[model samples]
Target: MSEQSRGVTVTPQDDRYPGLVEGYNHRFTGRPEAVRLAATTQDVVDAVQDALDTGRRIAVRSGGHCFEDFTASPDIQVLIDLSPLAAVSYDERMAAFAVGGGTRLDHLYQELHDGWGVTVPAGTCFEVGVGGHICGGGYGHLSRRDGLVVDHLYAVEVVTVDDTGRARPVIATREPDDPHHDLWWAHTGGGGGNFGVVTRFWLRSAGPRPTAPEHALPRAPRRIRRADVVWSWDTLDEQSFTALLRAYTDWHEKNSAPDSPGRHIWSNLIVLHRSAGSFILNSVVDDDVPGAAELMAEQLAVLTGPGGAAPAHVEEQVVSWMDTWMPSYSWPSDPRGRYKNKAGYLRAGFTDHQLAAVHRHLTDPGYDNPMACLVLTGFGGQVNAVAPDATAVPQRDSILKASYSAGAWTAPEEDELHIAWVRRFYQDVYAETGGVPEPGDVNDGSYISYPDVDLADPVRNTSGTGWPVLYYKDNYPRLQRVKKRYDPRNVFRHALSVALPS
Candidate 1:
């Protein structure tokens, strides 16, 4: 390839090229001219500069867990891999935890919990990189009590391209008086690959600055109570299924308050297609909470009581937080790599009519994919305590987050069949809104973390709302301004990236 930088550069002829070209989703791959393995901030700066100097389109990859082809598109000529920059430590100078942008969630949890009894409320997918997750306003089990990852963000070190096309590292913090304060706000939930390559992020709880590392972030839970409740397809009819979903959502609507007792409880209802044999509801709560067991039991009773169909199986346990937070912790695996994901935020529970659509699609006899499923995860609580304009993530009143996904296929020919199933399933659920979730009283719009390009496609998204409005709401204009100031050349961009201010 061209002259190499300080970091290692692999070209198409390199033996490692094949592996680097692909990402978590096997659906997309790139044949870039070169893949630069950046191990430090300077390395990323040099790599980005090289790409700009050569007039080659570039993209950055960390844990390779992106659901879309943003980084692996064929148009990318230079792929900058940041996995080597993974590092986690307390920054004495900033009085915050300094996490490498490339660090995985699992690694970050381990380092934070082991070194200091603290952790950020990040996503549960251990393999996800912090680079995109934090910027996209990630949330997880602790989110109900702790808020989103971005809510605790103190500062970020991003390598940005100036108007002169020179790449340099800049540090932006939450301090309003700071010159680059807006840059920090944009990264809060602006999504990744929009402004520039993030080299590092410093996290600290919002409030008075803590003098010690251990007190810098939210304290990690000592133990957690978990329950797995499953119901077989044979046990569920259309009425029962609808009741079950309604009951789950209704509970969240009532309990998703900043000071609600149920804020400590986090649950996910995984509704699989009939071909999967059964669906599951996984719930967790901090065992240290008073009456934790009783709270979980009561929640379970509400769900089963409505349907009158007892769960086919129920398992409960109490385990150390490390047992669940460690990188070794594993969940059910999908052998098939290719997948499609779409998500939306719900301000209230699904109506009866919407529930019927969900039941009809999951039980459709024409589609037999076992991996196809709908997941509704608990959201809000502390996440809603923040003002809508305080961060780029403006959906502050959502109670539940719903994700529609389809996977488990090895052949490319099955792409159309699997993709169409999920698209139709999502469309029918929001049929009242022109085939996509539009901002309204019930649906607040979609999540940027689970980026769905289909929202940008006119053929798929019959809704008049554009993708920018769906993901950012009124915050899009602010993000566009940040894009103009930091990346005037638009050096960092992808399919769903913020467009320049017109």
Candidate 2:
């Protein structure tokens, strides 16, 4: 295939190849023979078709924030970079906001709020790509109030290869009678890179769209309050530590009901590894609501507990909605470098045993990565309002979502140490469930966006459950069917991509 046919193809010898192949995680390097930096939907279709014709393994990248090396694997020979196709506009035909697959969260937020005074409940990281995030049921601070980003997704434009080995573009909408409705559901949460390449997403909530543009989607929050509270590691003994955790979880359990007033608040308790010095609880709440301050104060008191004093450090500030969200909300001091992440959901508070395991791992002195931490973020609320089978994302009853991450590796030799530390930590935490979070009493399932390839390994996933079953639950079978229909040739696939069902 010629470069003209594929839009813009950069060979390994090209100067742009280095930046084109680089993703958020610097640990793993992608060395595709050529990179197709797509500038339009037609460009993506051309690139995929050309790769298919040439018998080249293809990988797709948007904002390049995939936690795993799914987009950066050595097996890939052609990478279709969608970052240059960032565009957000109102689609009169669909009567919804259309966002290009490569649009970043920050750009999307600004365009939606400024142009339309509306927004989708999306990822916290400003630089995250919309394609993979929404496809994997993206959620963030506004999620508790407005629900998952996919909940607003009305339609998707995708390029796929059929049984004839022909690549074509199709638009799938949520309308019941739409012939491609199944395709739309698959993208809701089937996880990215399984069925096809998503070129654009049209977002509009289920109900009717009023005549006004602002009413098309959920209105942007008037104001937001940010609060931070920290407890020194020295101040937390095992007893206080466990109490603090229980307090945080207990509050979520009570307030996570679909209609709870506490739904206005979103927070994450960052239980930093001991090397970080202090563990902190950061929260954001809708400042326009009544009793917002009182609600935050109440939650803070519960977290501190009866015996424990106030947080050693506390700061609260009110900022414009755009200010809190537009700036980088990424947690790490150095997020652009090496990192590994695994994710899981909790239906209830962590058991005493689980809490102890977390304490043990966080306090382990032998693991010296300062940036290593286990983050438990508040979930549920409006998210649980939808039925489990309503969309492809099945974990509707989860109260909290937890992520295990380790980063900032100084050298390649240090990679094993960081990996071992995080793996051991996760395995011990879920030891009773055979290593990883198997769907059961304590663990609901895993989040697909986190995409941990380790879960597919027999050595790492002693969970007695396969990776797909853990991530998709009963939704896996349906997703497999969609995979068979949309990607019969299986052109868009990776190590953990959905298997073609027998």
Candidate 3:
């Protein structure tokens, strides 16, 4: 569309590409075909159009956190970077915040809180881009109380490809009469990079849903009383391992409900496999509720007071009365790393024998690290009550959310082990549970939030189920339709990303 973008930039091109990545924003060292720091929505559209015209393999990098190198791949020539376009604007009439796709959670948090005393429900890591985080049904500390991030999406502005092989970059808004409404629907929990480059999003997600108190989304308790549960690896036997896991499972089952939230209870941020020696479990309570610390103590007594001696490591912190949680509150000490994670949707609470299996895996001296912890996120509040056909992400309220074990090292040597451990652990756990997809898949659905290409990988997983059903469930078909209407040529294609029928 412009004479200036006729050929690639004359910048020095780094001839070789290895695992070339940087943690900070200014890390594009190699001279790419062209790296246009897009400053506006129109710039993004122009850059995409130019790439299409030249028939170049274009890569989009926002915070470059695709861990799998989705941003700058092994063979990408042109890169349309939205990193320079990070900006946040508040519009009073919409009562919404417009966020740049390249902006990270931390930036958004500061801008929103400092400027408006409001915050978006997002992952715990402050670094992940808001776009990808929301795309995968973004959830966080506020999840038990608030639904996924996309759950409150007001609209989006996307740069897409039309049927005639033309770049059609327009703001796809969520409206009853909008023709591209399907695009808006897909944007809701359809996973990022599958549709198009979302320049910005208008979010309508609000905290404190209006359900009855028992059903109201769990908010941050007035005050938060935090405590840790630590057990040394050398101190336990096989039976101890089994009992520990069983205790966790049993406690989760018996105390995982309406009462927990009313009492402002969240969960034990269990640091399982020790990277060093013994791991830790960071647990929390309603700091607002008087005697909240004592209450958590009582609960722990009921769960783990048996033959085990006092915890080998214990730490506690107590804070303010207001209740809230930040982004994906997680286990990884290093938020930025090449990593792959898989998830399972849970229905029934795991049984004792199953808990024993869990212990075996967790206590495996080999599985020493916080990454090895099975993150058990609670999922029973308003999450389960959504109407099935309402949005694409269809895991409407279940009992608990299960994230498979292992956070591997960043070094290439440890990469294989980390991924292998996660995959094998998930496989074995599912084997004990029945099969991959777990017999009673929550509402016959899974979440798109935790993306696992394994579902589509015939070698590793033989679930026969495609990525759509695993994440979108019945909503997959609609997403395909949205993909068709918005990006007919399948321009925004990525591994584990959704594609429309040819």
Which residue ranges in model 3 land beyond 4 Å of their true spot?
1-32, 206-223, 250-263, 289-299, 306-310, 320-338, 351-354, 365-371, 408-410, 432-435, 439-449
Whole-model Cα lDDT per candidate?
A: 0.89, 0.86, 0.62
Residue range 140-215, candidate 1, lDDT tens digits: 9899999999999999999999999999999999999989999999999999999999999999999998989999
Count clashes in each candidate, considering only residues at least 3 apart in sequence or on different chains. 0, 0, 23
> How far does residue 191 in candidate 1 sit from its true spot (Å)?
0.4
**Poorest 10 consecutive residues by lDDT, candidate 3:** 209-218
Task: Give the candidate order by descending TM-score.
Answer: 1, 2, 3
Which residue runs of candidate 1 sit more than 4 Å off their true CA positions? 1-6, 324-336
Using lDDT, rank the candidates from best to worst.
1, 2, 3
TM-scores, each model vs. reference: 0.97, 0.97, 0.82
Q: Write the per-residue lDDT of candidate 3 for residues 298-408, one digit (tens) a residue.
A: 666754578333468766777642323333243233534456667777666565545555666766667545656677765555555466567776776456677774554
Per-residue lDDT of 177 in model 3: 88
RMSD of each: 2.3, 2.3, 5.6
Task: Predict model 2's lDDT versus the native.
Answer: 0.86
